[model samples]
Target: MEPDEVDFAHTDAADRKRREKATELARFAWDRAISGAELLELPDDRLRKLARAAGANPPSTRETWTVVADLLDQKSAWAAANPDHPQASPAHADEKIMWVKRPIPPWT
Candidate 1:
């Protein structure tokens, strides 16, 4: 079977909206991450997953924040796209956004 590029397997409107929100949040967080902006690092991944949920082809996860900014900048032209969601609007831009980062133990 061919891939569902148009819908990507999602059909429900609610699911589509949820996915859109997730992507918006991800881009917002990505902008902040590469900009050296301070964000409220959530105490857990439960909430952080919202921002990274729609990442089908996210930047390499093996690297640390040290080189993520440089890599992301070159990988794609990710402008600080303003989100339509109220929470991500310019008014709340200063508010501490709850973002998540991978929580893998160093020892493997």
Candidate 2:
């Protein structure tokens, strides 16, 4: 299938959302790896061990690096297209929400 074609494999909305989130995280990881993050700079053997611990199949060094490069390219293109936009920060489960109390509701 062409890269532009829709992927029917992820037809479910939740699955698509999960895949999008995973891609974002992967891009962030790649950014850290290229920005002198010691953990991300670990050798291939160590990285493979870490992947195994996370219950993920370890990719070859070439494949991993290639993906990082592709993600970086995609990010760069997005930044170019939206020069004023800021990239979103990762969401936290413990984040707090503020509620506003109005004297009257709009319906009234």
Best candidate per lDDT, number?
2
lDDT of 2 at 36: 20
Question: What tens-digit string does per-residue lDDT give for candidate 2 at 1-108?
Answer: 898998654568745544454454455443333222333445677556544543455554444434444564566567568767655321231221111112465784
lDDT of 1 by residue, 6-91 (tens): 65344577455544553454455554442322223342243344335535333222222223334334323333343444433333
How does candidate 2 fare on TM-score? 0.34
TM-score of the candidate numbered 1? 0.27
Off by over 4 Å in 1: 1-11, 34-41, 44-108
Structure candidate 1, residue pairs in collision: none
Tell me each candidate's TM-score: 0.27, 0.34
lDDT of 1: 0.39
